[model samples]
Target: MFSSTIQVSVFVFVTALIGFLTYLSCRGQNRSSQNQNREYFLAGGGLAWYFVAGSITLTNLSTDQLVGMNGNQMALLALWEFSAVVGLFVLAKVFLPVYYKFKCTTTTELLEQRYHDKHIRAVISALFFLGSALIFCPAVIYSGSLFMQSMFGVDLPLMYIAVTFVVVGALYAIFGGLRAVAVSDTYSGVLLLTMAVLVVILALQAIDYNFDGIPVERLTLIGDNDSPIPWHTLLTGMIFIQMFYWGTNQVITQRAMAAPSLKEAQKGVFAAAGIRLLIVPAIIVIPGIVSYKLFGDIGDSAYGKIVATVLPDWLSGVFAAAMAAAVLTTFNSNLNSATALYVCDIHESYVNKTPNVPKLSGYVTVLLCLVSLALIPVYQQADSIINLIQQLYGLLSMPILSVFIVGLLFRNVHANAAIGSVLFGVALYSAMSFEFSPMYAPFGLHYIHLMFVTLIACVSFALISNKVIFNQKAEFSLALYKEEEAK
Candidate 1:
């Protein structure tokens, strides 16, 4: 049976209404000026804590978290959810302070400072773009959009609406810039949180009210002993997932920098982290588990079927809308950051030092759209969505985080040391990647391994090289003077 058209229409209308408000909020800004460039690029240093919190939360919560992570949780069923908690806390504590202290636009910028080298900056920035473009954004978009189109019978003509959503999001960033992205994220945050809570509540009620009540085992984190995803994989793999997500990814950190102040930035990071900690179990893991419990079997194809079949009419529609928003917010944020790197870091930094802002933003928007369209084919080629995201994150984070930690923590780190650490980090990560990620351990120590490897390598290189290659001027006075002047 089809979903109630009325409920579906209402859900669609509400989301559209939110989008309209976001557009209007962006209207007050100078959409086509050089002075507006930084604001358009960075939200003008005026990002409210609410939008910062919202955008960060929304960006993190996507089809990757929804479908891919949910799938992982159901596979491991217990240990994975706990890792989610760990990831949230790490983001709240470790990376948040470093980001705020430096006032970084890109995570790589922080690396450049610590390493005292432009090469380090350029390398990390490139990794972020490659990760988002080739892996993160496309996988989520194709999976989420395809799931909705198939579930709702949204034919090809109507299905293009999904592409329109991406285009609109790009324009929002291109024209209105970061301010617009922030406002749109606020709308997405409220809707995503409310809808997730609602779905969880409805699911709990459905389970409680249906049959002879929900089974106690369904509530347990460990589903069955025979599953391939044992607690071992869940715990170890989760450490990698969490640390990379919270500590390294720039799309998430971009919002942190946009916070009104350092205190607000901390609060926003903590708040968003807290919300994400709860959201994964509620909307993703719990529902997937419940669906398996009720339906008795849940293969990869069974996810969408379970949602439509189980939930009430209105709620199902709402779930559809929420999924759409999750994918859009995530894709939008990634695209915006990717363009910012292209415009601010690559074009403005090197090729055309004094390029016009409006024209550059416009050009970057067009380039990203083409790249995204090309990536759609790559997304179609991928089989395991989760694996794709993980692999991408793997290649991106290790090299970049190595450069960043050198910049922030290792004051004596030379440019060559920084650059050398990155080359080594990338080489090691690439070699260890498809394997067991020897970086991931059996104990909780697993999550910190990559961070440890990256940190140790950079710091060691910096220290060893400091005696010979120290830039006394850049280190003692010149860099200090530059930092003072930047302030």
Candidate 2:
């Protein structure tokens, strides 16, 4: 082990560099009312292509994927990243053009415009907020701190570390808004992804360029239905999960919405797809499997323990900064989106029509940080971070994806009919997942395949509801989705 002085010096240097970059990017943005809604919530609608790409990649790249996927301990987990490419392509080619045309502040705004109803917007927005406050934000903090504690061997209490992350991550969200969150994400994303690649290389070296000791199932592409990622589920549910996440989820799509122009945003989305194809697959899988070789079935501790084992003593500090960056990016990104949903969908709609948005956002950010922080202990009980995430969202993701699918595909489906699908979806998926509470997973299908069942049921019921209950109105026309211009 290195001297405490050396560790302190390296850690301080790395964090200071991160601070400098953040200040540099957000220096000129101030808290003016006209600019508040624009700059704070949407980065003044002026984010460039590179920043857009970096923010998008980093927002999703944190411990949720890194620690959680690695915790699964298999190369098959790489398919999650691989499937995301198709999702990004859809976002760029299918969704980006329409979003830019409407100038939406959040993903739900597009839902409202598409259906010509604010209620539809509010429902989806509420789902986004609930998902963030209850599940996404807390899980990020929990999983990230778990990794940090394992890697650094911090002597502090786990709750103390969780609260510390909240304070730091909250500052990034409350002080800067989307501009601050997006810029910091891009700046730190570079260092974080680079260091992750280095870990992959070092992990291979630690194993002496061999995979013989690792289990065959861990290295294989095909997973049984009982595996965390079943191969059959990939053909059915994986694509939709990626689409809902990358294309429609407010936390991620918020970054895409903040771009300067449609062309630039498309470039960013495309660029992120390219990065996922190569870099992300390694970043998520190799280190965990390598840790299997070195440490033997450590579960979630694999990532932190592997990083600690493989990197040089001095580089550990830099890696710490990178991990902190990843943690903060995902945490702050959710906080910003949570604030946006409240202000745009709830507060402005009900509290005050012309409220001081900056002040309101600040208030919302603090409240959300506290709520999310309080939920950290809940996540602490999870068996597998990634599996917990999928299980939690299983109740919402497919159903939400159905809303977009029905709204975008069927022109005659009115706003009221759309709401029925969303409500049904939420209720239906919850019942199916929680059937184990009072029942069992209706006929033994895996949750992933069950997602397909849920989607089809939502769509079919929506169509029937539109025809019988609401009397299909041509309220939203198919022609609204124009061919987005080529870059």
Candidate 3:
């Protein structure tokens, strides 16, 4: 116990010190250095392709990848890992062009411009931001912390870690803005990927290069349909979920918006996709299969135990540090994005009318910190963080994607179509998840299934009503900012 305590303390201290140094390095340019609001959020329209790639990779490759996806793949599904590759293709080829042309801060801004309706923009933004904060962000933090607590045998209060996470994350953003987040993300991304590679190698070496001596069939994406998750359902559900996550999730898309050019941004997306394609099988799915092989009767809470028993002492400490970094990086990005949505989209547009840049930035940070702090207990007691994150995104994604796709592809989807689509999507998705069950009528679909249903429903609704909903063609002649023009 004493050795474990010393090890964790050393790891925490080193992490804090490195993060503080990163914060200092990024502190040079004040908020005034940003010439416009776009630069403030998008990193001065000059983020190199590498930083864009690193930030997006770090943002998407979080505790969910390590804990939830990895856990599921090891146990019941291998098709899930392949979704990362497929999703990357969609992001690189399908999603980037529209966002590049529109040049939006929040995804909902595209909706407002296309539909010419403030109500649609407000609803989409609110749902996206809330789902990210209340569900995805907190769940990832909780999953990572759960691993830490189990690994170190430290009964560290969830409240303490939650407060610390929010405060430090807010500091990174409020002071340095998006640039700070991007810079720190570069550091975190390297640390995370390196350690993940190490974990894979060490796990393989420990298992005598045979991957837990499992038979060939288990490694392949084929098995009986009677399994808890059939291969057919896994493929369909994961493809849609991955599309919604990579293409539309603000934390990931915001990194692309921070890129210097459309080309560089697309490169970043490609690089991120490449990394996911390589790491998913190595990091998450294999670990799960190995866990079951090494530890008998492994359950959802057994991931850390598997790692601790399998890895050497020094390596275990390193793995824990890497997991913590993943959690911290994910939490920080979400808090930063959520604050931006509130201050830029909601506050300045509605409440403040004219916001003081620095002061508003600080206020947004504090507001998010307090809200996250308040939710610590809720997160601690939550039974299923991964499930919650998926369900929240499932409920909220329909409208956001509906408007985004309409604006990008159709260019004539009416504002009312966007609004009606969101209303219908959210209500229907929620009802399907909560009200329908197998006993009642074999609602046998999961949350990921519902996300696709919502996506289709919203798209069909938008298309059907386009003619009547969009009575007049909206103007699209707003001049690009000087910085965007320079690009």
Candidate 4:
């Protein structure tokens, strides 16, 4: 009983310390009234490379990655992290320059500029908002609450813990904006990363570094056809998935875009890429694999159980604090990005040309938080949160990527054509993924491969629909490249 009190005390102390540090770091920076949109959403373009790197890393390195990836309990899942490195590089080298040139506040803003239509931008932004509120936000909350319950052996209802997380995370997004979110993310990231590495070392020690009893498929890097990630699917949809996520997703890209210059943002992205390649893979997968040896097939509960087992009581509190920070950072990052998308892309375009930035964002954040909390029960039924997130994201990921692809790659394409293709891609991927249609089995393709196919189909539909239905010719060329070269 006394040990539990010490653990809770350490958890609260570390959590409060990080929040206080973040408050001090962002104390006077919120005073800018000139271009409140940029100041509030983009941090007035003053974030240094280190904060940018740290925010990008922690924002993506939340409970979803930790609990979900580790839940699989296999080395094969490391491919997700390995592939993400390429995604981050592409974001830095390719997308950053375009965003800088366009001076985009939100990623969808570039679409409006490229297509010369605000409606298409609004459509795409709505999709991003829905994806976050529906899938990413709730999953983070559910998984994080589950982790806390498992780690502390708490008997509290999951909804009670979830509400606490939602309230605290909403406060961060509401009060601090992106600046506080980034600062807190960086601070929490250092603690989380250190603790995660220690957990890895301790887990290995607990198992005496032995791997004799684990199944071969669990230890193998090359996934077979029956595996969650088939080997051939990596060559097809994996790269594009990384591209769409790291390059275009507003929650991740907003950090890079907030930097003062393209070079600074790229530097931050490169640092994040280095971390993903080196540190992220092991910490995410190794603990779960070792837990399998120690506890058998415990599923998503593996990570928290292992942490509780390996760490001393006092240290488990510190780890719990780190995990809580991970949850808050990720949850608030999505909340902040969702607010940015709505205020910049949808609300500003449709309702008011110049709405109150903070006021409007607070309303949006509250609405999103309520919706996310309500959706927590939906994710609770999933077998694997990580895999479910990946599969379910397909409903929007490829379709949205197609819009950016068409908008950037070709000229004279109608905006409605792109919108049409987006709807088409959603319907097609849904029919393929879910059981309402006959496409899933007949294709005999992994979902990853289906993502590549969906992408190609969406792009093709957009171009072809432009020519056939909309009666506009899309002249394909490297116009972005040519323009950059000339500049």
Candidate 5:
């Protein structure tokens, strides 16, 4: 490790550049005075392919994935990033067009249009907001701060680092909006990928370019039944997981939603897919693998530890800046999306139809960041940040995804039926995942398998209740949905 002066100087210089570039990137966006909500929330619906690609990748790439996946210290974790390509493809081909057809400001708004039920839209948007506040926002800050502390060996209090992350993220979301976040994220995304590749190279060289010393199981992509990612789960649940996250999640999908045209948006997602295939696996898993070789089973600290151990001092500061940018990318994305949900779903719909959207959005962003800061301690107690995320996702993903599935697949599933399906899916998944006595992971099935059970069960419930309970007339027509979209 180099002297403290070098680390301090490099960190300051790199971070200053991050600020200057962010300001420069968002300057054009600030001057646009039209449709405040569209300009601020959705970047005036003007993102091109490259911005879409960069923003999506960075928003998803933070130390949460790096630390959390590497925390498992297994190559099997590459499945998470690799499988995301499928999710992006599905988003582009299947989901993105529908979103464009409807011209939704928020992803959950599509549910309202689909079912002609504002209540369901509110419920889903609330769920997205809750997930962001409780799970995503906190996890990103905590993990990024953890990585920073490990890399710099800083003596500062954890909350100080947490506050800095929260403030920077809030500024981007509050003032700069989606345009600002996307621009900064794109630049950081490129730098992060480049620096991460360097880490892999240096790590390999550190180990004398030999693989024999690394544990075979750590290097193997095939995960055993007990492994963090079982091989079978990839087939059973991974695809749906990817779709729910990339295709439907507000934080990630909002970037693609901001594109000015369907073609531009689609190209952005395609670029992300290419990056995922080539750059992500190398950066996300290789460092952790090298960490495992150097220091046995350090878990979540593996990424930070490996970066600190392998890179030169100047490079460490540079990577730290990239890491900060990654953390902020996720944070800013979540904040922007959360604010969008509130303004569109709750504030405009319920509180004030004529409210100043930009003003309200900024206020909401600040409040949410504080709440997220308060929740960081909850994540600090967790044994593994990624596992906690997956477990929590168990409660939300399949059930939420089912709502989209029913709406898109069956023209005749009534609003009440869709409601029942979503509610039942949530309840059943909760019971099985939390192991509430007799309802536990039915027949000793894995949670992912239980997701399949819950999705099928929910669909059945919706269809059954529509036919039997409500005796609702079944009508099959794309025209009904298109009518809403055209509005």
Candidate 6:
């Protein structure tokens, strides 16, 4: 009983310390800028490279990656992290220049500029908002709550813990805006990364660095046909998946875009890529594999259980604090970005153009928080949260990527044609995923491969629809290509 008290004390101390440090870092920023949107949402373009790197890293790192990837208990899951390195590079090299050139406030703003249509921007932003509110927000809360419950062996109801996260995270997004979210992410990231590495080392030690009893498939990086990630799919859909996520996803890209210059943002992204390649992969997968040896097929509980088993009472509290901070930082990051999408993309375009930035964001943040909390029960039934998120994200990801591809690669394409192609891609991927069609079944194609196919179809549909249905000739352009080469 005394041990539990010590653990709780350490957790509170560490969590509060990180918060105080974040407060110190973000204090005295000019909140009353002429462009209030830029000041509030983009941090007035003042974030240095280190904060940009830290925010990008921790915003993506969260308990979802820790709990969900480890839940699989295999080395193959490391491929996700490996591929993400390539994704980050793509963000830095390919996407950042265009974003800088356009001076985009949101990623979808680039689409509006390219296609000359505000409606398409609103449509895509609505999809991003829905994807965040429906999938990411609830999934992060559910997985984080589960990790806490398993780590502390707490008997409290999951919903009770979830509500706590939602409230605290909402406060961060509401009060500090992106500046506080990014600062807190960087601070939490250092603690989380250090403790996660310790957990990995200790986890391996607990098992005496043995893998004799684990199956070959579990230890192998090359996934077979029936595995969750088939080897062939890596060649087909994996690169594009990384491109879409790191290049275009508003939540991740917003950090890079907030930097004062494109070069600074690219530097931050490259640093994040280095971390993904080196540190993230091992920490995410190794502990879970070790847990299988110790606990035997525990699923998502493997990570928290392993941490509790390996660490003593007080250290477990520190790790718990790191994890809870991870949950809050990630939650608020998404809340901030989702509110950015609504305020910049939806509400500003549709409602009052000069609505109060903080006031309107406060209302949207609360609405999103309520919706995310209400959806926690839906994610509770998932067998693997990470895999489930990847699969479900196909409903939006490829279709959205296709729009960017069309907008960036070609000229004279009608905005409605791109929108039509998005709807088509969604329907096609949904039918294939839900087994409404047996077209892919004969070849035993994985859903990842299906995503690639969906992307190609969407791009083709957009181009063809432009010429035939909309009676506008879509011309392939090397203008941006030449401009990028000159740079």
Candidate structures ordered by TM-score, highest first: 4, 6, 2, 5, 3, 1
Evaluated against the true structure, the overall lDDT of model 3 is 0.68
Q: Local error of candidate 5 at 449, Å?
A: 1.7
TM-scores for every predicted model = 0.81, 0.96, 0.87, 0.99, 0.95, 0.98
Residues 1-487 of candidate 2 have per-residue lDDT tens digits of 5555576577778877887888898897655666566677888888898988999999999987899898877899998899999999999988888788878888888888778888888888888899998989889988888877877787977778788889988888887788888888988999999999999999999888899888988998888877778888888988898889888998888888888888889999999999999799998999999888878898888888889888988888888888888999899999999889988888777678788887787788788878877888888888888888887897889888888988887676777777788788777777777655543477877888778888888888888888888777434446656554533
lDDT of 4 by residue, 208-286 (tens): 9998899999999899999989898889999999999999999999999999988899999999999999999999999
Query: What would you estimate as the lDDT of candidate 2?
Result: 0.84
Q: Record all residue pairs in model 5 with backbone atoms less than 3 Å apart, i.e. clashing.
A: 71-299
lDDT of each: 0.64, 0.84, 0.68, 0.93, 0.85, 0.91
Give the number of the best model, judged by lDDT.
Answer: 4
The regions of model 6 sitting more than 4 angstroms off are 436-442, 484-487
Best by TM-score: 4
lDDT of 1 by residue, 95-163 (tens): 666666666677667666565566666766777787777777667667777667655765675337557
| Per-residue lDDT of model 6, residues 341-381, tens digit only | 99999899898899999999999999999999899999999
Clashing pairs in 2: 39-44
Candidate 1 Cα misplacement greater than 4 A, ranges: 1-8, 30-37, 73-101, 155-162, 209-244, 296-302, 381-383, 435-487
lDDT of 2 at 176: 77
Q: How high a TM-score does candidate 5 get?
A: 0.95
Q: How far in Å is the alpha carbon of 311 misplaced in model 6?
A: 0.8
List the pairs of residues colliding in candidate 4: none
Residue-pair clashes per candidate, as listed?
Answer: 2, 1, 0, 0, 1, 0
